[model samples]
Target: MAGVRVIVTLNFPSPEAAEQAVAGMAQAFKPVLQEPGALQYELFRSVDNPQRVILMEHWASRALYDQHWNKQMREQGAPDQEQARALSPTFEFYPQANYDLVDGIWQPLDPADRMTTIRWA
Candidate 1:
């Protein structure tokens, strides 16, 4: 089975809010790095627009992703997510875009029409 890739864009009111959100999320999700099925978790900030942040997560399977959330919400009862959301009233979480890896190439799961080949420099 192919793995799942999740990308989310967060638009904050200010750079300070964006940075705070990243720091809180990183600390909150630190345990996710050891979670089963967790492949990659990366946070990025736009150079031009410091208030824009991007969160990228990869999981071994959709099932694992769902399970992770269920565990976090039900079993762990973590409130970091809620706190992060309170950072800014204008904080926005754009719809998450989920993709799948096909033979190491990433492609949108819904359409699977567009493909992205990543090359590390």
Candidate 2:
């Protein structure tokens, strides 16, 4: 994929922990806004389950996203992976896809037709 969208779902042990994790991630997001190739970053709280939190990020490329993740942000006052793990021990990272709106329609940016069909389970 030329660009990538990463979706991460974190399942906290409690609602309080999930809220705390969101606060920590809000702080962590500051540096990401300044980082190159960081297109968009958003955090969502699950209405059905208060203990669940989701993070969606759009990057110029997978390599750039990897580079950003590789950086140590603890010294910069951002919560590190260990701290996040402490808050939410179970997390799920969805497969990345490159997609965008073209003429107000959702379309794959890359040549591959990975999202050609919508499968409803």
Candidate 3:
């Protein structure tokens, strides 16, 4: 079976700080991505979240990914994605959603189909 596309977002104090974090992250996930099920991991610093970062990852299967999250306790031997996530960071797992329903992949808003406000319900 295929896997899910997870967007892990983070924020920094300033643009300079974000840049530094991005660089640090580039080297941090080296060992992580090498692990099983960690198919692909990409880091992105958003224009909106100048002080923030995003991690787009793809896994071989949700089970393996879940194992990584549940068992990857640096407490045992693994590494924390990094030490920067302690700053009010959170994650949302939308197992039902992917880029298919969304038109543009990276750019969420398309000028041709832009809407003023969005309502979840």
Candidate 4:
């Protein structure tokens, strides 16, 4: 691994709420429009069970990623904001691991219910 990739697994109160919100996110449709420092960003919904959501974020650097995570927008405002209210997300960033990708690509998934998953390596 070379750079930093933050893998955040948000545990919602229920699988249904998680599924509903994941389906409801029109704002999340575009990853490129997200924060500029994000080298890559992705979303996932558990296949066996829909409640668990995964977010993978690749940053220009670990420090940059840390900065982005600590910023008020992500820590405090992400929940209050309109695009994030439906999503009761819990986040975590790495203390170590320079997330260099061997293949440079992540898998993709499309669903009929309420989930969109994108991958980045």
Candidate 5:
């Protein structure tokens, strides 16, 4: 089964709010890290934009990710729709067949995999 990666970007009104949100998220997700099929989960703050936060999550498979999501909704209740909209979060997903770690470097399993290249301006 291919691994699933989700990138979630959140925009806050201020740096203080972003920091608070990050702290809250870290606390809330502590148990999620222990959930089965949870491959990786990390939160990062944008250096250039203090009001921005990024959540990087990887699941062992799509089914596992869905199972986690369902469990969260069931346990925590569905998030308030209006409140969630106010946060203005964006999300993206990537499905990868395999990954490799060579010489402390992470890369796709297939040598010919055309990974996206980011060119910083």
Candidate 6:
């Protein structure tokens, strides 16, 4: 199965707020990085707009992604919309075939080959 990709954009009210939010989020990132099937999770700040932050995540499979969500629900419950709104976060998910890092480049799997699920650590 292709891994799941999640892209989240956070637009804060100000650069200071974004910086503070990033610092707060840093505390949460280590635990996530230690989770099973967490292929990659990274945060980036926009060079032109310091108030903008972007998160990129990859999971080994849809099942793992769902597991992560369930775990979050059990631990933190649903996120507070009011608190989330303060940061203006936009999230997007892609469930299609994933790419492989080959020779320092990302290479998409052949459509026919992608039907067979492959796991990457």
Candidate 4: regions farther than 4 A off: 24-34, 72-121
Off by over 4 Å in 2: 73-121
What's the true lDDT of residue 11 in model 6?
Answer: 94
Winner of 2 and 3 under lDDT: 2
**Candidate 6 structure quality by residue, lDDT tens digits, 10-102:** 998999998998898878888998899898888899999999999898998878878988999999899888988987789898875757777
lDDT of each residue in 1-121, candidate 5, tens digit only: 4678999998888999999989999996779889988988899999999999999999988789999999999999998888778779898988776666666766566554535422233
Give the per-residue lDDT of model 3 (tens digit) for 28-106: 6887798788878888877766787888888777787887777666436654566545545666554321223344343
Evaluated at residue 70, the lDDT of candidate 2 is: 73
lDDT: the better of candidates 1 and 5: 5
Which rank order by TM-score, best down to worst?
Answer: 5, 6, 2, 1, 3, 4
Number of the predicted model whose TM-score against the real structure is largest: 5
Q: 36-94 in candidate 2: lDDT tens per residue?
A: 98888899999999988888888877788877877754435565677678655443433
Q: List the residue pairs that clash in candidate 4.
A: 1-100, 2-100, 3-99, 23-114
Residue-level lDDT of model 1, residues 30-73, one tens digit each, is 78979999888888899999988887888877788879879878
What TM-score does prediction 1 earn?
0.61
Pairs with steric clashes in candidate 3: 10-53, 11-52, 12-51
Steric collisions counted per model: 0, 0, 3, 4, 0, 1
Candidate 1 overall lDDT versus native: 0.72
What candidate 6 gets wrong by more than 4 Å, as runs, is: 96-121
| TM-score (all chains, Cα) for each model | 0.61, 0.63, 0.59, 0.52, 0.77, 0.74
Please report, as a residue range, the 10-residue window in candidate 5 with the lowest summed lDDT.
112-121
CA-lDDT, candidates in order: 0.72, 0.74, 0.66, 0.59, 0.83, 0.83
* Candidate 4: tens digits of C-alpha lDDT, residues 1-121: 2345677676666888887767765356464336556776777989876777887877766666757657736555655555454555556664333223335643222122113333433
